[model samples]
Target: MIILASASPRRQELLSLICDDFSVEPADIDETIENEIELEKMPEYLAVKKAKHIQGNKHFDDIVIGCDTGVFLDGIMLGKPSSESNAAEMLRNLSGRKHKVITGCALLYKDRCISFSQTTEVEFFELTDMEIEDYIATGEPMDKAGAYGIQGKGTALVKGIVGDFYNVVGLPVAMLNKKLKEIISNAEKKL
Candidate 1:
């Protein structure tokens, strides 16, 4: 059995593409980044933390997957927007420039854990304030990292992507499939 250690509907939706038998077991992990931690390490670190939190529980022996995603613009990490204006600001900052979407995934079962990070470079068309404001008005950008959802209406703002599109959507499906197969193989070996 597989368990997902996250509350994100996006992560749940992405995981559903892989298997339908899995269960959701959202973990309560600390999301605060360490003051000394580098920006690039945030996703992996958080992913591990979330996975460990779930693995620490004694009730379940299933493989648990945890993931964290963030959007980086000019070296700053943009989380979910706090308000419509903030979402507008995030969209404006991403306008006509390339930004990175980083998502880290972790798989854990018992004491063994594996983690990997995927980075996707996304280019955005130059967006006017009206466009940004209009996007914010839809209420879609408020809950997404970098104030955009590549798989939804937010696609209108993106010009192109240079890496895995699934990563921008919240999971790196190709890399995840490879890693998940390896983990399952190892677990079978132990059995």
Candidate 2:
């Protein structure tokens, strides 16, 4: 059986494109990023933690996937907003600038694990305060990293993207599909 360790609907939806048969098992773990973790490695660190947390004894024979995404602007990570005002501030900071969206993914089975991170460069149009306020009013940015959902109403905020569009949505479907294929192939070979 294949299991996904995430509560984000976007990740679940993206995973479905790779495999139709799977279960959602959101991992329960502390998500706080420690000061010692490099900003670029934060996603992968959290992702491994989540996947490991879900891959306990019961799921020893099953494959578990965990993913963590973050938006980085000028070296600082902009996580999910704490409030509507914080969302606005995030949007303002991203205005007319290029930022990176990185999603770290880990796949675990038994004692084996595979992990990788995908980065997408997204540029936003110069946003006015009114536009930021309006987008925040839609309430789509509250739960999304960087206070924007590139796949939803927030699409209007993006000017262009240089990498996998799906990566910005929370998962890199193509890369994930490739990784899943490798794991399944090796497992079958062992059998």
Candidate 3:
């Protein structure tokens, strides 16, 4: 069985694009440690941590997948907003700027873990204060990293993205699809 270590609906939706046999078992971990890791390494590190946390209880035959995402501007990582004004501030910081969205994925099977991160360059259209506030009113940015959801109304805020569009949504489907195929092939060879 494939187990997803997340509570994100976006991740569930993205994972469904590649695999149908799976269940969610949201991992409980203190994300505060992520604040200490280097910006570029934080996502993958957290993904591995989450997967490892859940794999401890799963059967050896079960494959556990965990993922983490973040929005980076300049050199600082922008995580989920804590409040309405925080969300607006993040949006203002991203406005007219090309920021990076990184989604890290980890797959744990048996005693082995494979992890990687996908980075997508996202350019935000110049937004006015009213635009940011109005979007915040809809309450979409509060739970999303970087205070925006590229898959929803936040789509209007993006000018264009340079990598996998799904990465911004939460998961990188193309890379995951390829990785899944590789794993299946390896398993068949072992058989």
Compared with the true structure, all predictions reach lDDT values of 0.88, 0.93, 0.89
Candidate 2: tens digits of C-alpha lDDT, residues 55-103: 8837878999999999999889999999999999999999999999999
Q: Would you estimate the TM-scores of all the predictions?
A: 0.95, 0.97, 0.94
The residue pairs found clashing in candidate 3 are: none
Consecutive 10-residue window with the lowest summed lDDT within model 3: 182-191
Best by lDDT: 2
Candidate 2 TM-score versus the reference: 0.97
Best by TM-score: 2
List where candidate 2 sits over 4 angstroms from the true fold. none
For model 3, how does the per-residue alpha-carbon lDDT over 1-191 read when each residue is reduced to its tens digit?
Answer: 78899999989998998898899999899876645678878888999889888988754567788899989998999999999989989999999999999999988877677788999999999999999989999999999999999999999999999999999998999997887676666656766
How many clashes in candidate 3? Answer: 0
- Each candidate's clash count: 0, 0, 0
